[model samples]
Each structure stands twice: as structure tokens, then as C-alpha cells.
Target: MNLANIQDFGAVNDDFTNNSVSIQKTIDYCAALGGGKVVIPAGKPYLSGPFNLKSNIELHLEHGAVLKAYPDESVYTKSAFRQNMGEGTIWIGGENLNQISITGGGTLDGNGIFFMGDELHDSYELKPFETIDPRPHILTLVSCKNVKMHGITVSNAAYWALHFIGCYDVSIANISIYNNIKVRNSDGIDLDHCQNVRISNCHIESGDDCICLKNRREYEELGPCKNIVIANCTLISTSCAIKIGSENMDAISHVTFNNCIITGSCRGIGIQNRDEGTVSDIIFSNIMVECKQFSEVWWGMAEPIYITAYPRASHDHKDAGWRLKPGAKEAGIGKVSNITFANIRCKSENGIFLGAASPDLLDNIRFNDIDLEVSKTTEYQGGYYDCRPCKDDDFVGEQTAGFYMINAQNVYISNTTVNWGTQKPAYYGNALYAENITPLILDNFNGTAAFEHLESIVKKGKTQLEKIAN
Candidate 1:
């Protein structure tokens, strides 16, 4: 491969000098020469502003090399393609490209603290523009195909660390990302409206969701995100560790998460369909989770597994001076069905929550060979379920259950076990609680209590419960 070194283009190793132009020149030179490797050598740190990547190019960094973003906001601008969800600038990005790769053992630092402003510690409300400054995402690939990212360490992102929007045939492996827990909106990796993606052997620690999948809001015409596989990853986050939806405008299907470890997260394995999308054929297996409640600054309530399908409100669409107009054709509410969670071992403060909004019901969900333990040693004891249109203001009373289901259909729990902590609070009562459900099946459900007590632990409201004979 042709080698284009940035050092040859007058890019200094000093961290102070802005290396944006030099790096861009090297990348352009490599692309002009029929695409090759643009190498950043080791020894010192190089600082730069936003730069675009080109097709058929490999941006390779040697060991001990650092490519850090320049902290000044004036050096960067919004992308011309306007492919991103938020107003955040793109630090290192590419659009409408093919066969691009980023492979390195070096570090890419965002210098996010410089842009986050002074009031960083406060629980900044999550309004569209009220929370923080217009910080940039570290790396974004938009509408690209045949992308590969591996063996890189990305840290301290101001917003989402790595975002892939409308990309296909992507493979990401052996990467590490560490964002501060105090940093808001610092999601680890977002796969938006992409297909045939495989992510494996990564370690991610972030303040927000660790790994998230979304159907693009602006590019709903691109279709759904499908055939994604994420395995052999270690994740730690204040928000959900693995999530699908929460911004889905189209279908998202055929996704799987396997052989993963999730720790210190507020939620694990969440599917939140808020728009008129259909999310189905999802699976999570052979996972271990250790989750606990965090302060009110975060959104989740330490639920080990939470799935919900709800209609999106107008206010939910209004973010960053942008509003998704209500569709004139009356799209039906979102649907979540054919989901399976098996071979999961979880220690959580909160329990599994399955909720569906009005006129829609969660369908055909299954949990098999799972073991869950609920601990009482948490700071937040609200014990309330967080469903759509039900904020903290609508909390009726304390909740007491290992599994809470509402407005669901054809849910099957087989070979699952629940363990309640000895110090059960007054709010803790049943092992299973169902409301407005139909055809809920329990097969070989074992708990710490006796079989009779465990059977009594099931509390139902307007639900047809079935205990399958083992």
C-alpha cells in the first residue's frame, strides 16, 4: 500500500500546534494517489481540528501516538452533509464513502472537558439546548460502506464517542473507550440505520449508553438497522449497557448481543421503541450484569432488563431547534415483539420492566434460563415503574416485584430463577407482578422462597396466568 505520512506534510508532533490542515493534506494526498495508508507515527501527540476521511484509505496510528482534537470551538463547524442527529460538530468524520478503515493502538482524545463549560457537575436538565454546549462527536461515519475500525483507544468524548449513521458492512473490534462518568450524553457507540454490522472484543466505559442501535430519524427512507451482532464485550455505563431504539423511526431487527459482561450500569439490555417503528427478532444471551441505581441525573432506575414500546410525543421530537412533524398518514404505534433473553445472570437494584403504551402491546417475549437477584442496598427506593407518559410525578406508590409487566401479550418465562435479598424493604413484595397482560406463562420458575410462596408471589391484574407443567 502507498504510505502517506503526516510528518512529511509538515505536521509537527508538538501538541500545541494545530495539525488539522497538515493531516487533511496528507489524507487528500493519499486519496489522490488511488487510496493508501495515511500513517501517524509514534513518539508525540498531534492536535487537530475536524477533518474528513476519504474512501479506500486507512488511517493508521503507531503505538504511543496520540491524535487529540483541538479544544477551540472556532476551529470546527457543522458538517455540510447534515447527517448527524444533534448540532454537535464532527471531529473526525466521513460521508458517502467506501472501504475506509481506522486501525491503531494509539489514543484519540476529544478534550471534552474544555468544551463542556464550567457547570459540568450539576445535574443539567436534558432539554434540547439547555444542557451543555454544542460539543462535537469524536468520530462519525455517515452513509459509508465497508468500514472497519479496530485496535483503537477512544476517550473523553464530549458527546457520542463513535457514531455510524446509515452505513453498511461495518466491522468494529478490539476497541476501547473510556469517558468520564460525569460527562453527560457521552454515549459509547451508536449504530444508526446500518446493516450487517459486527462488533466484538471491545471494552467501553461511558456515562451514557454503552452500545446503542437506532434507526435514523432524519433518514427513515434508508430503512431499518438489521443483522447486527455484538459479542465478547465488557461494558460499564451509567445508562443502559446495551440498547436498541429510543430514536427508531423505522424497523430494527435481527440483532443479537452475546457473551458480554455489563457492570456498574443503570440498565442492561433495554429496548425502547418510542416512534412508529417495528423492533423484532432481538436476542441477548450468555450475559452477566451488575447494575445499581445512580443519582437522579441519569434516566434509568437500575433495571436489569427494561423493554417498552410507546408513541412519541411532539415535545419528544423537538430537540436542538428541530422538530419531527407528526406523520399525516397516521402511522400505528411502535411494536416490540419476538424478543428473547436467555442465559442471563444479573444482580440489579431494580427488576425487569416490560411496558407497552396504549393501543400497543409488547408481544411474544421470552426469558429462558435466567437468574436475577434484586438487592435492597440502593440509595433510590422509589420502587416505581417507568413507563411511557408516566414520569416521577405520576408514581402511584411503591412497587414490589422481580418482574413487572403491563399491557403485554404472550410472554413466556422458562427455567428462570429469582433471588431476593435478605433486607427486603417494605416496598418489596412479589416475585412477579403483571397488569393488563394476556397469556403470561411461567415454566419452571424458581425463587429463593418455597414453591408455594413463590407461586403466591405472582400478583396479576386482569391477566391470564398459566403455569406450564414441567
Candidate 2:
């Protein structure tokens, strides 16, 4: 309310030396004299493009301001930004006017290694002096509502530094995003089909997927992304530090990922709702992980808390039959119910792949107090005179297997621990790897790794529960 009668776009004896045409003529003279705040004072370097925020505006970037991003393309000729979706007509977006507030702490530079990725798809092929593509994101907000972005310091982004689509009562607090390694793909924060989103105390590091959750793309009439809350984040990812769905069909309910801290990730707490829909009450509580390059865990897909509902044509086309099938009366493969993974701690070189390619679409899965360490990449694959964590041969039963439950159902692995580092590569054999699950509940599951058959699965579950009590 008190933006002190706005109008100071890099003011220092303001002769308006093109601070992007003086912050777009003071935001078109405060939206034709009705709105306020466009001040970006305190030391200067304001070079903008693609900033079309209006309704109740308050876009101030104080504290030694450095709002730079003039990768130029006639400064975006809007249609509410030429229909966005991976956006790249060059920069800023907050689709559809809303009460916006982009707070300060100064610094929003997206010179972004000078727009790689085929010059941002040749400026969306609308060629006409085209050649200004810088990976497409310095900031994006689609289908906006009451939005608030706090204390920013967004770094090199030509792609996903911060993006929110189908937004709702959103609030992104204390943000700081980093995109080094030459900013390839550059994802640090992306939440599609957003709902009551609240991302707090962020410090995301990225080359890709530091924090992502997207849904509703197959025949999109998008709706259904409920009560979201992600707290106290500090992720370091080269990919997947915390992810959900790969465009969930059209439903991601009651979500809550509490107290996170993941390190050197290629996969640490990832869930891919196999491209259909319906991912129920999610919760990944009190996590702490450090899995330094677990042999690249196939970073670009293939097991790392991965899931599948399988109608496979690489997840069938033609709207995947509007997915929601749990008992198939209407198509198939879509349903990952009430999930919970409490107190997780992991260290992998290929370990941890939880069930469901079937089993009527994976149900009530839980793994409490879980712990893992399946090291042994052998001092970086030189084999270093074959250092195999004191190999005695059964090397944890051919070294590869911590938890792979396929076709899963009411599965639970409580109070677990599996530490078999340095006998890696019999394709990662087991600690608990079930197939065609019927009855699985290994409580107080302790580990040292080579549980080769774990006494024939506890003597065939005590003779099949005494043959169902005779």
C-alpha cells in the first residue's frame, strides 16, 4: 500500500536510460493510473523484457538491484504470452492478470549462458528477425491468482528457474535458485496445475529437477491438485531430488513433503505417476539422503523411486483413456494410493525400486524408518585392483537388491536397514525384492545385504500362515 508513490526504475538522477524503457513506462503508467509499485532502485542494471504484470501490481526489487534479462525479441509481443507450455518466446510470464507481488532482496539475472537449446527452438519458429532464445525461463506463472513470490535471488535460467502453471493461492518464500554446469534444461522449481501451493525456505541447486510436480497433460481439461505443502527445502540435484508424476493424468491429492534435505542426487525420493492420473494422499516425511553419483542411476529414467501403471506404448497415447482405473471397468493402469515413506535415508549405486507394474495398480505402500547404503562403484570404475568390500564371495548374494516390489499390494517394510557396500554389480541382488506380491510384511527388517532367500522367506511365511490355520 505504501510503495511511496511508485516510479523509480533505476533512479539515479533518472533520465531513464532505457531500464527496459524505464520499466515498461512504469508498467504502462501503473496500468493506466490505477495500480502501483515498479521501483527497482539501489544501484542499477535493470534490463528487462517479458514483464506484463498488472492487476494490483507491486514489483519492487530493491537491495542493490540487478534485474537483468534483455535477451531481446521486440520485448515479447503478448497474447498473454503466445500460449505458453515450456515457454520460449523469450522470458517473463504470469498468465492472466492477478494480484501479484514479487518482493525483493535484489538479483534476477537470466542472461542464461546466452540461450542454448537451438536458440530456444528458434524463438518458437515465428521467424522474422528471430534469434533471441535463452532457454525460456527467468520466471513464469500461468493461470495466476493471488500470488506472492518472496525474497528472490534467481540465477542463470533459460529454462525453469521458477515456474507455476494453473496457479492458485500460491506463496513461494525465501527463494534462491542456482543453475550452473552451463544451465542445461535448467530446472530448479516447477509445479504445474498448481493448487494451494506453499514452498518454503528454498535453496535449490540444479542441472535438472530440484523440485518438480506436474500433471494433467493428456487431453488436458486440467483440474485437481490439492492442498500442497512442501517445507524447509535444501536440495542438490543433477536430477530428481524430489519429484512427483511426469504429468500426472489429472489428480494429485493432499500432498505434504516435510523437512527435506537431499544431497548429490540422481534419484532421491522420486515418484513418476506413470503418465495417467490419480496419485493419492502423498507424504514423504523427515528425509535425509546422500547418494553421490550412485553410478548415474540412469538419470534420464529407469528406476530411482520410479513407478509405472503400465498400458505401455511408453504410456499409451490418445489421452491414455482418461486414467483413473483402479478396478478396470473403464480402461486401465492408473492408481497409486495412500502412500507414505517415513524417515528415509539412502545411499545408492542402484538400490531401491518399489513395486507396481501391475497388482491392480499398486496400493497402500509404506516403508517406515528405512535406511540404505549400496555403495561400491569401485573408486570410480577403474576397478582399482578390484576393491570389493572384503569380498568373501556371496558378496551379499551377488550384490544388487535392496527393495524391488513388483505388482505390489499392502506392502510394508518397517524399521529397515541394508548396508552392503562394495560388492556391487550382479545387477544389484537382494535385501527384499518380491515379485507378484501376495503377502509381504517384513517388520523390524534389519540388513547386512546377502540375505539370499532370507531363510526361504521366513519359511514360506510360516507354512502359509499354517495353511490358513488348517
Candidate 3:
């Protein structure tokens, strides 16, 4: 591999004005010359559209170099596999490339705010909509291998900040992603059909899930996504801090999230395996969550570590839609199992809620060493109004349980603490409720005065008395 400086190769600086072909030509030249480093000089801003990469190439940016792209849709005339989805038409996809590294203390601005779709831009012109996806994303890597991206600031993505599709052996570190909340669908990073990836030491803030996982389609024959780890990250968003699909059916397994700090998000952590797909063997440990101001009344919209396999709009009896109806036989799309949430501490405007569907389809869930507190909301969020005073009675459910088991089984909660700052209102407050569930285990559960303790509450339940494990 060789090093090719953009300056040395006559790369245009501060002139995106008709300079789209210049950068692409440089990348092609480097690949043709058997790979090299394409350096962007310091203190200069360059402009180009959809710069593609090849084997053994490094796109290095100096301390102050900036790459700005034009927002004109026509300028990005490349095809789907080459051009941006719709935005200013930047980097389309990274496919079948190997040993690539994008490192720098520079900025890659999508100038995405301009193309944040017509509706969002008109509705909320003043607020930030960083997560809004006017296009596919600022960067998309597909079917690539052994890639490393570090120390770059990616902002104002028209869609997801970074998207990995069918890529393997990749590492993303020390990157900063910020999206304007007014921007719709501006997810921080999305991993779809990817494997063996690691994301750490990143700061992600967006309108949607900071880091999201997907399986493409329910029965698309797509590859399984596994062995990915996310750690040492910070997240704040309007959606789940970390979310796993409403579009899964393609099998996502062996993913882990550890040692992260989340604040001011709709849900601290979320795991949603809708009836369309299967997600198993996922783990969350050593995480801290601070709830901003939101309510999760509807199971579908709430976040904070949830896993639902409910039926979909297009689902039918033969296509896993049976799970949606109240008493239908469990569909066979797949199950969510072997998942664990340990050493998680959450203090929020409201208590935490964790639940899933019936047995024979979803099982093996555990919560250990969990500590949570439900704070009072100062304002309304998610269409609900929080009207509690300093000394009013607001209810507190068991920190470990939010709702009675709808049809869940094999659920275990231990070593948990739930501190309610206010008594539950007349509407919702049960320390823990288990309905239509069997073989549920509760151990070392503790709650404050707001809600009765877990052990005693269950002992007095109206259900049959059969405890498999204390």
C-alpha cells in the first residue's frame, strides 16, 4: 500500500463547485495504483459527492479538513448502488472492499439539514432534526471486511449516521454522531445483516435510536447478524437509546451492549423482536439510565428494555400474524430467548417497564442486580400530561415489574430495587403484577413505600400457588 496526498494529486480544495468528479477520480487512481492514502489537507474544506472506496485505501482528513457536498438532487446522478439514496448524494455504499481505514480529526458534514424531506422541514423549521433521513445516510458500508473508522465527526445525516449492511469484521471507534431531533428517522447508527462488528467510545445523539439493529425483512433469506458488541457509549434521543428491530425476522443473535450511559431518551434501552423476526442471546450489563420526560402507556411506543413478538400489519395466520390476536396459537417466525439484563440502574421521570409475550415462543429472560427510581415529570411528553405536585400521591410499581404478565412465562427478577419518589396516581400502581403467566420467579425484590414489596404482593395474589424457584 502507498500514501497519496490529495494535495499532491491535484485534488481541488474549497471548491465543491463542479468538483464531484475530482474526488472520485482520485479514489479510482489510488485503487488503480494498488491502494494508498488519500489525504485531505489541514485548514481547507473540500466538496464532493458519493466518494467510493476500494481495497487497501485510507481516506485521511487532517485536523481541520472538511468535506461538504451539494444538496442538488441532480448532482448525485449515480445509481442506487452508487449514489446517495436522496439527499445531497454522498457516499452510497462500501461493498466487497477490504482493509480500509477512515481516520481523522476532521468533519464530514452531509449538509443534510437542507434535504430533510419536505414535510419535516416545513413543520418544525426552528428545531434540530439530525436524525431525519432525507436519504439513506451519510455513510453506508455493505459487504465489506476488516474496516476501521475512527475519530471523525458525522453530523446532519439525511438518514442514519452510519449504516452497515452485510459487512463483517468491522470496527467503529471514537466517532461522534449528532442529529437534529426535528429530523425524522435520523438514527445514529444502524447495523443490518452485519456480523462480527464492534462499536465503542462513541457519542451518539439523534431523534431515533442511537444504535439500532435490523434483519432487513422477515423472510428475506438474509444473513444472520451476530457477535457484535457496543460499549463505553453515551446516548440521548427521542426513541429507544438502543433499539433492536420492528423489522426483524432475519435472525439477529449474540449481540451485547455493555458499560453505557444513557440520558434524556424516550426509553433507556429497548429490545423489540416483533412477530416479523427472531432475536436471541442478547445481553445488557453495567448501564446507567436517566429518564428525561416521557410516558410509556402503550406497549408498542414505550422503550426501556422491551421485547415484543406481536403480529404485524401484513401478518396472517400462516405468516406469524397469529401472535397479534389475543388468543391465537404462537406463530413460528421465531422466539426471543437467552437474554439477560444485569447491573442496570435507571432513574427516570417514570418507572421502568419490561415485558414480552406468552411462553412456548419467548422465554429465558432474567433481571439481576437492577436498581431503578421513578422521578416526577415536569412537562408532558408522548401525548401524556404529568400533573403531580411535590407532596401528591403518585403510584410506584415494583422497579422490576411494570405490567402484569400478559401471557409471559419463565420470567425471573432478582436483587432489584424500586424507589418511588411519588405515590401512584389512581390510575396505575402495582408493585408487580403477573396475570396469565406461569413459573414466574421473584427473589430478593425490594420497593419503597409507594408500592408494596414484590414478594409479599405476589404471595397475596389471586393466582394458583406453585413456585418452581424462590
Candidate 4:
């Protein structure tokens, strides 16, 4: 149990040399002697390509230390794990290890901008590659147990910041992720088929989903995603702030999020079931949300709370991939049930939406003590429902409603209120718009339809269109 320093093992912090081999040797020496601490001391930055993490080894970085990634792409290597995110390249990884922790209040810079291409408009397009994407993920820990990562700043990942696949008993706290908002696909904290995870007291800003949970198609043997708790976190993103499953091929359940704040994001608290995975027993409570419509370059369309079940790329999809085995007909059949949201507040250009493929596909949804306000907060166009990567149109041009529910069953709203801004558009209408819902209950609902002041609280039947469909 020796405390090894990287400098002693030939890792000089020159900021020009590829110190990956030196870092790897130091880690190996510590791990070979029954595991210990390896310190990247606070000095000049250490530029490195990639290295493997060891079991029972604490990779501690001092307060001013920075372990930065080398920009060159050819020095990186692909993963050996089968079907784990298509075996992508990774920066720091540990497979089948236990008690692996990355601690100390330092930074891990991914140097993501070096891997991007010229900017068209909203975002920088990724550089074209021959095979799979060559961008290295910042961190990938596969099937590791008792993992701890805290007091660190992870910035500018070309891909996902922290990806834990099929791992268990993970605890992440007091860390900050600052992925550039214009960098597409730079996600933060992706939990794929992980269990017993707790994430608290963190701040994340990203271009993609801040925190996403899914069970990918090829990783079905890892089992369902369950028992995740996230609290006291602030999230900002260009896509959904917190999301579950656009790539889920298995089941996800028993997830809870509380006391989180989202500001100026595209979407918040999204449950998107696009594949065969069934989603149930998810609860979000005591959260504040403020979202706006970004340009069509991003995934979401400003819904504060969006829950939808759609197929991933049906035959009707204009940009369908080469392999569409299910075709458009048998795309999304996952049942989403027992979802609840409580004590929430939202301010957004758009409203809350709960749409499903069928009435039976979504059930037992509840909203309690919700306060929502809709306003014209952005120049981006509103009044369109975004169901991207679906069988039909990616965006459905529906009239904006404070709370729109369609193709659902057993939905209950209690003590919820809605308010429209003074300078709202003509496209906004209806405090509660319902279509194809069974037994929808409204208890103590207090709000009028936007601009219309409709006499009926719950409006059904024919709807109003803001503009003609494109």
C-alpha cells in the first residue's frame, strides 16, 4: 500500500509530452503492490493520451493540478468490450474493477474543441470519420463497483463526460461538469444499466443531455437500470436536462430525482422511451425549471416536462438508418406506467407535454402542486411538439397548451396552476388540453386558457392550430 507520485515514476508535468506511459506505469506499480494512492501533484499540467485505471487505486489530483488530454486522435485506442457503446475510444477507463475513485479538487480537461469541425450555424459539426466516431469519451468505467468521483471539474469532453456502463454502487458528489453549450453530443454523466447510484450536489452544463439513463440495445445482458437517486444538482443544457432512454432496449425502473434546478435549457425532466424498454416507477419532485426553445439544431423544444413514447426511426422516418428491422409499424411498444411529478415550478416558452403512442402505452401519471408559467422568452419558434427520432414527423405542430395530455390513461392533477406572460403569442391557448385520455382528473386546478380565457377548464375535441403544418 505505497503512496506513489507520478513525477517519481517519470511523469513530468511539462504540458507538452505525452505522459500517458509514465502515468500508466505509476498506476501499475501502485496497483501491483495490493493497491494504493497515486498522486498527480499540483504543478504544470500533465498532457496525456489515455490510460487504464486500476482496482483499489485512488487517482488523486491536487487542487491546482490538471490532467489534460492530448489533442491528437491517432494516439487514442478503441475499447475491447463487446457492444458497449459500439466499443468507442475512451480517455480514462477501468473494467471489472472495485473501489476505484477519482478524487481531489482538480481538473480533467478533454480538449474537446480540437476534435470538432467548422461551425455552420448553431453548433460545430463533428469531423467525419471512416468507421465509428473517433472522439474519446472523458471517462468510461465498465462494470466497476463501489466507485467514487467527487470534488473534480471535468470540462469540454468531445463525447460523454462520465459514462458508467453496467456498474454498481456508484457515488458522485460535489463535482462540476462544464461542457461547452455549442459542442454537440458532449453529454454529462450517462448511466447505462447502472444500479444503486447516488449523484448529489453537482452542477452540469452541456450541449446534450445533462444526465441520461438508458440500456443500450447491444448491452442487454447487463440487465435493467434501477435504484438511482439524484439530488441537489443544478443542470443546464441544450437538450434535455435530465433524461431517460432514447436508446433503451431493456427496462428502467425505481429512479428518483429531487431538489434539482434547471435554467435556460432546452428540456427538463424528460422520459423518452423510443425502443422496447419498459419504463416505470420514476418520480421527480421539488424541482425548479426554466427552459427555452433552441434552434432545431438541438434535440428538445423547450418543454419543461416532456414524456413521450415513440419509435426510433420507422420506415416513415426520412433519415432512417440502414438497419430498420422493426420497420415503422413495430417501433415503439414500451409501456410507461407509474410516473409521478410533485412540487414542481416551471417557466418556459412551451408547456408540459405527456404524449404516448397509445392510451395503454402510458398509464398512472400524476402531477401535484405544479406552478407553470408560459411566456415568449426566446426568438425561436414555439407551438411545435418535438418527437424527434420517431416514426412520423419529428415535430408535430400543435397549439401550445399549458398542459397537454394525449394518448394517456389514469392521469391525475392536483393543486396545479398555470400563468401566461403578458407578451405571449397568438399560438398559445388552453390551460389544459386533453385528447384520447381516459379518466383524466383535475383537482383544484386554477388557471384560465392562455389569451382565450375559455369557459371550460378542460378543453377537448377539435383543437386550434397556430399555423399550417410545414
TM-score of predicted structure 4: 0.93
Better of 2 and 3 by lDDT: 3
Clashing residue pairs found in predicted model 1: none
Residue 1 displacement in candidate 2 (angstroms): 34
lDDT per residue as tens, model 4, 159-269: 888999999999999999999888888899999989999999999999899999998654577888999999999999999999997877788999999999999899988
lDDT of 1 by residue, 1-470 (tens): 88998999989977689999999999999999889999988887899988899999999988888898896877767742265435577899998999999998888888877776445443333334442335778998988999999999999988889999899999999999998767788899999989999999999998889999987566666778999999999999988899887777788999999999999898888897766778999999999998887776676787899988765544433331222334432224578999999999998877788887641458999999989888766767657755432211323225756887778988899999888866676666567877777888899987643123344345556788888854
The lDDT ranking, best first, is 4, 1, 3, 2
Better of 3 and 4 by TM-score: 4
Top-lDDT structure, candidate number: 4
lDDT of 2 by residue, 349-425 (tens): 65666544467677777788888777654333311111111112111222246665557666676887877675564
lDDT of 2: 0.62
- In order, the Cα lDDT scores of the candidates are 0.80, 0.62, 0.64, 0.85
| Rank list by TM-score | 4, 1, 3, 2
Alpha-carbon runs more than 4 Å astray in model 4: 79-88, 315-332, 453-470
Writing each residue's lDDT as its tens digit, candidate 3 over 1-470 gives: 66666665566675546445666677778889888887777775776666677888888877888876566544554433232222222354567789888889887776666665444421223233242213536777777899899998877765567877778898999999888755656788888888999999999987667899887542244488889999999998777788887556578899999999998777677666654467889999999987655333212223345555443433332223322334544333457778899999877655444344345455777889888765455444322222111112212233333423434557777888766566343333444555544566778777633444424344333233343444
RMSD of each: 3.1, 18.7, 7.0, 4.4
